[model samples]
Target: MEHEDAVGRRVYGTDHDDPSPGPRPGRIYRELLGGPLDGQLFDVTDWMPEDLFTGALLLAPLGMYGPGGRADYGPHEDDPFGPWIWGGDTP
Candidate 1:
């Protein structure tokens, strides 16, 4: 299958934290989609020269950029790590 472009393609990621009822501590998962990886919780060891931002974005959340640019399935402070979307909204 042809992989989607890393830039806009959505990526779900989880930071290392203790698990909790709402959002696990170390397992704080979030979807990485759009914008740069400016607010990443973890370090992206590797990424293609051109795909650097793409890989970085995968490891972080959209909120890193800002509030308005955050993803619909937000991992933001208000809606952190939940309701992951694989293809559509039914997960």
Candidate 2:
């Protein structure tokens, strides 16, 4: 299986001497399918209510180059495990 790489390439805060802990438990990785953050892997592991997967979510567009907006995404209807489709954005 092909793995999806995260857009957050630079390691922040972690000490250079420490070894990577690897993937954490209870991590739910989902891909953002559109908008300025397209193809970005979003981790929705600790989202409340559990049904958050059934509704759209508003996320800050920090991943986009020179961000100044927000992106909205909804769960894909056909594939529950699929990428979240972009709904729109706000400036």
Candidate 3:
């Protein structure tokens, strides 16, 4: 089953992608499916068309680490609707 936040934005969990609820009507969201951010939703509805986001996504480090470190996630097989897989952390 899928869930929605207080204002009705979809919130996908780590082990719940049933495709039954499907995506929200006009929302552009991606799923993170591994590493530190497994099962998290990434909302990209406001991104510009030419941002060139096909490369690795750098997120804040999850565990104890120094500053300027990040976790990486790469696009999974070029799926337009994505579930980006984790690539590890750089510290």
Candidate 4:
């Protein structure tokens, strides 16, 4: 993918001539939302299912919440994190 940023910065660009390698499956797990946990937190492991290796794969992280957690209907009022809803759409 090749594109310019908002400030006209030539960002990531991949050369088409370069030979690409085949897709490889791997596993990654994170404890907290942003950091490591001392004990067993939400452990998630991901791998390309056996049938999905023939093409490129886009992996997105999924999470599970415990009791008393607010359902993330939309962005928070205080904006603790970055913009939740992207694009021009509003909540």
Candidate 5:
């Protein structure tokens, strides 16, 4: 899981993280395999961490249903139209 970035710094562990209590095997499989969401959501709770970018990207679509359920892009909203360039000029 190691890679050299454009600037030559080594990057690793795109899939690795500090482990938590993780799922009780077979729970996630059953959930995605057409089970119910009752116990399903808790299954992978331990695997995910509090990452800003990844969390935002993942939850933005699902409308995050927790204490932060209200945080979401509106369903009728249009995609952002401009490049998010910083400290630079576009020509």
Candidate 6:
């Protein structure tokens, strides 16, 4: 059997190409609903597609309350992956 190399686990699915279809910001600034709601998050959460939200939720780190951690992989370094993982600054 042939095995495939997996790098960066999936957030929503194995298909990494299916990026979110809309704006990825968690909050939106709106000016309409008077003072309190003005310049505040408009609660557009209900407007977002379920798949996109769920997929992002999966990608988020459960412990950190988010997955905003930064990961930089260098070509010449080896450890988490390997030097030969790629030939440039990124894989």
Predictions: Cα RMSD each:
15.1, 5.9, 7.7, 16.4, 16.8, 19.5
Model 2 over residues 7-79: C-alpha lDDT tens digits? 3421222344647522334455566677766665565666674565674544454634235566777687787
> What does candidate 4's lDDT look like per residue over 9-91, in tens digits?
11112123535311213422221122111111111234343422221111112213333222222222354222222112111
Q: What lDDT score goes with residue 6 in model 1?
A: 28
Model 2, CA-based lDDT = 0.56
**In order, what lDDT does every prediction score?**
0.29, 0.56, 0.54, 0.22, 0.21, 0.23
Clashing pairs in 5: none
Ranking by TM-score: 2, 3, 1, 6, 4, 5
By lDDT, the candidates rank as 2, 3, 1, 6, 4, 5
User: Highest TM-score: which candidate?
Assistant: 2
Candidate 6: tens digits of C-alpha lDDT, residues 1-91? 0012222222222233555322234432111111111111112334444322221111222223335421221212233222211111111
Candidate 3 segments exceeding 4 Å error: 1-25, 48-56, 63-68, 78-80
Candidate 5, which segments miss by more than 4 Å at Cα? 1-15, 24-30, 34-91
Q: Provide the lDDT at 17 for model 6.
A: 59
Error of 3 at 24 (Å): 7.7
- Weakest lDDT window of 10 consecutive positions for candidate 2: 1-10
Off by over 4 Å in 2: 1-26, 54-68
lDDT of 3 at 1: 15
Q: List residue ranges in candidate 4 displaced over 4 A.
A: 1-27, 33-39, 47-68, 71-91
- Runs in model 1 lying further than 4 Å from the true structure: 1-12, 19-38, 53-91
- TM-score, model 2 to reference: 0.55
Compute the lDDT of residue 89 as modeled in candidate 4: 15
Tell me model 5's lDDT, rounded to 2 decimals. Answer: 0.21
> Candidate 5, which ten residues in sequence have the lowest lDDT sum?
29-38
RMSD of 4: 16.4
Q: Residue pairs in steric clash, candidate 4?
A: none
Sequence-dependent TM-score of model 1: 0.20
> Given candidate 3, what's the lDDT at residue 75?
66
